[model samples]
Target: MVAALLPRERLLMGPGPSTVPNRILRALAAPTLGHLDPQYIGYMDETCELMRQVFQTTNQLTFPVSGTGMAGMETILVNLIEPGDEVIVMINGVFGGRMKDNMERCGATVHAVEIPWGQSFTLDQIRQAVADHPQAVMLGIVHAETSTGAFQDLSGIGELLHQQGMLFAVDAVTSMGGHDLQVDAWGIDAIYSGTQKCLSCPPGLSPVSFSPLALEKIESRTTKSRSWYLDVSMLKNYYTGGGGRAYHHTAPINMVYALREALAIVVEEGLQPRFERHREMHQLLRSGLEELGLEYIPDHSLHTLNCVAVPDGVDEAAIRKRLLNEFDIEIGGGLGVFAGKAWRIGLMGESASEKNVLTMLAALKKCLGD
Candidate 1:
């Protein structure tokens, strides 16, 4: 028989699933409530409200999907896109590539605009893509590319797309609470994010929001969404129907409690201050890494997730293993083209702290034999 499981605690400074605060852990341990329980409904409503505040949008379709961030991505794509529909996707990193894959799987005609892995798309590039693909229904991009630490600007792109009569979708999995995202002001038609990154919650739920225009497109779709589990029309009935809530699936009771607590923590600290904290911590980490003769990968780096180039002749895998086994600090390795050449050190949510920054710098210095 297996004994009671005991996992060693490590400081999580990785690409995602940042350190969960003790308060959130306590919330996760709260008594399990029925999926349709009146009390749980109250908590559910409050969670949606908190998510809207964090997303800075009044989208009525905003709620936490009962899966990871990828689920949220699929939810938006499948619901908004039908077979043969034209969509333009910006591919600068792994997540953007995944978006293109998902869009293709949805039977949509995807026009992938490729760029270098560690770079971001300029507004002119996006305009060119839109100009070339005049029939596209939506344009998707990643606000924070976790794999490469590229931060894409959404400032004028929304208005540009709106003028072209196209929907704007964003993958905000790594930027939700760590950066300043104005969904309404930016005119993002559809957006998806995870609770694990800047929210400091465990990896289970995905927070998503869809604008009225996106919902209108979904409503006007000729075919049903390929994914029944991710169909927003059905989900809206359960999350924000007219009368009594209809049972969809067994909601993740403890996880919702944890998300509520996490969002509450974010609200208490205030979004602007929290964003500033991540920026300051990233600068602190960047200065230390630069002193150690390291370089960054992205031209426009993300404050939440930092991807830095590893030094030549150093065994990156060995250093990562040593940091995990000896120092009990968990950082992430790179993905795609950056594999074996870069390290992704995340300053996300509760993990973004002065203490953690100093600790990581000291551990890495020792690992590098300096």
Candidate 2:
């Protein structure tokens, strides 16, 4: 067999998979232990605890699902949504659209409240939607819309959901470790996150949590979940340690080790500091973009995932390709309606540093011939 060779240098600044820290890479290389070993079980328990801390919740159901962001999204939607159930999904970006698709596939009637791309939903709009669909089982929104770089108003919509006595679920794939995600305080019922974003780990696992109300709904389901592997009911026993250490499936042991180390780095940096660092890097990037005469898509809800509107004469795809070929730096193009209109620059995890911001700015300026 030929030896596997790879590029020695590359910077990951894409939407989902941010640059993994060296510490996490080292942890992945640590001696592999038996998946069911007592020490490994203890490590699993510690990971669960760290997830709760990172999620800012006391929910016992907090654990890393053995998949990517979509896995976490599917796990929550498939188990919580039953046939003919009414799920009110707010769509302002691609992720929201994905949520609608998943919810519909779960046999729920998806009632969508949508706004223009690059814009977020207003409380008034959501209030109207809620009034229109009073029988909706859950209110789902994307906390950080990675596609549009729009941060939706969790406080306003969250209050309305609470008043309507509906479950609140958020797709926090891009916001979990970067922003101040208050799952319990915001009254969120079910939340999902990916390890590849602000977590600074590889993309194999998805950290997920369910509020007591959500867990209760899952437990009280009349029919078995459509997804057997993703059913939280069965998976909980495996993570929380029941008799015989029931093997649901083989866990991604090395990925979990990397994730645990990633979580440790988050704790060391502290969540507030981490959020501030992202904000600072974003500010630097935004300033540089503004200096280059580029404008941001979203207004007040501007996320660290800066989505800059491409100039009229710029070849968006060509520029991205040039950056990849010449600088070995990867940024993202737009999605959905914003395709070819904007560029996505991620400031997540270790990639959320001032040096990276400056490097990206210089590279982009060169790519633009500015």
Q: Write the per-residue lDDT of candidate 1 for residues 1-370, one digit (tens) a residue.
A: 9899887788999998898889999999999999888999899999999999999999999999999999999999999999999999999999999999999999999999999999999999999999999899999999999999999999999999999999999999999999999999999999999999999999999999999999999989889999888888788988986446777778899999999999999999999999999999999999999999999999999999999998999989999999999999999998999999999999999999999999999999999984
What's model 2's TM-score? 0.97
Question: Clash number for every model?
Answer: 0, 0
- Winning model by lDDT: 1
Each model's lDDT: 0.95, 0.89
Root-mean-square deviation of Cα positions for candidate 2 versus the true structure, in angstroms: 1.4
Error of 1 at 159 (Å): 0.4
State the local distance difference test value for candidate 1: 0.95
- Candidate 1: minimum summed lDDT over ten consecutive residues — where? 241-250
